[model samples]
Target: MNEALWALGRGTGVVALLLLTVSVVLGIVTRSGRPLLGLPRFSVTLVHRNSSLLASVFLVIHIVSLFFDSYAQLRVVDFFVPFLGAAKPFWLGLGTLALDLMLAIIVTSLLRRWIGRRVFRVVHWFTYALWPVALAHSIGNGSDGTSVWFLALALASVVLVAVAVAWRVSANFIEFGNARKGETR
Candidate 1:
């Protein structure tokens, strides 16, 4: 039973990693135009949304399974109460903060139509902070964080997100610049 739980935890972690990878790839590839391999534009958006949901689900499983696994010592408080994790408090708190921010994004997303686009857009910016915070958490508390496999995956995820963010920011700046130029003329 203990072994089963540990296996489940490990499996969840792997699934979470895969989902994150897929989402990041989809995000990066779709930035320019449509994706290959029969992937629809909406499909990319769906993949990003569903992958995030799956990642959150797997995170819950991973945290729960830690309680059952004798190897990884984790407490429930370490999740809700930031800066209290025995293993790596600073890193763990970051993970908690990421989760909180993700939740906020999710809530605002669900209420997008009702909340109005302006409000939704503002809240959505929180996701930008959430991604790096999650990466930091993974690096800080992850048992295999320093391993070649995990390191490669983490680096790829971080780089893709950074690129996407830069692209989006530059696009906004260009639009703002054009708007200002038009106003001046």
Candidate 2:
């Protein structure tokens, strides 16, 4: 049973990471105000929102499973606090911090209409920080962290995000240049 729990925790953690990667990439696409994979802009936004929610579900399962797994020895306080774990404090703490940030982002997003776009956008920006912190936590603390397969998975996630960000920046820059040229004309 304990082995089952451990496996569950590990599997869910990987799934959550993949889902988060998808969410991040889709988010970048949404912000670009462009369709992705030939889907309409609205469809991309919907998929982004749904993927984020699914990732959160997987993250919750991952945390819960680890908390129950004897190997982890996780305490309830450790769930909310960072750096207090007995083993691999720094790595586990990064995960805790990521969780905290994710909660804030989720809350702000849910209340976006009431809180206004500016405030929501500011909180949502934490996603940028959350992704790397979560990735570091996975690599630093995961049992398979050093395995070739895990490293390859992590590398792919990073590459996808990097490409999306580059595209977004270049697109914006070109738009800005075009606007400047129009002004000069």
Candidate 3:
């Protein structure tokens, strides 16, 4: 039924957001070459990769369910194009833009070996843009966006990402300082 499809779309979207939050945190941890929660560095990397893939799966389901739900009235063009939706075009467009970034990131990641690390890394940076855009889309367009639970979830995700980014920045600064000390010595 339409209600079932709507529920499926919303549920999958929430799950995808959570998974993406995990993936982003793990990715930062992996880049620092440090183990997370006592896991080995390699394990962190593996979890990061797996979580990203899982989030992509959930994202696909979310999109598909919404596309089928009559309430959404989504056309095929709405998937590829941004800001063209009949309802809440700006918010929906953010989701479309995030999807576009995700596609680019996924393709580049899959071809990393062939494209080389530099190119892959450049494309991967789009992920930084993707997460917030996706989050914005969720809050701006979602039916439960104003609910307490959804706001809590969004806040938690933001805090987690902010902390991870802070840690990465501080780690980099320390490493740079140590390198300078070594050079001076």
N/CA/C clash count, model 1 = 0
Those runs of model 2 whose alpha carbons end farther than 4 Å from true positions after fitting are: 172-185
Task: Provide TM-scores for the models.
Answer: 0.75, 0.94, 0.94
For the record, the alpha-carbon RMSD of candidate 2 to the native fold, in angstroms, is: 2.0
Error of 2 at 11 (Å): 0.4
Deviation (Å) of 101 in candidate 3: 0.4
Could you give the candidate ranking by lDDT, starting with the highest? 3, 2, 1
lDDT of 3 by residue, 40-136 (tens): 9899999999999999999999999999999999999888899999999999999999999999999999999899999999999888999999999
lDDT of each: 0.71, 0.91, 0.92
> Please, what are the lDDT tens digits per residue for candidate 2 over residues 97-126?
999999999999999999999999999999
- Which predicted model would earn the best lDDT? 3
Q: Candidate 1, overall lDDT?
A: 0.71
In candidate 1, what are the lDDT values of residues 77-120, reduced to their tens digit? 76677787776778879977876776788789899989999998
Tell me how far candidate 1 lies from the true structure as C-alpha RMSD in angstroms: 3.8
Clashing pairs in 2: none
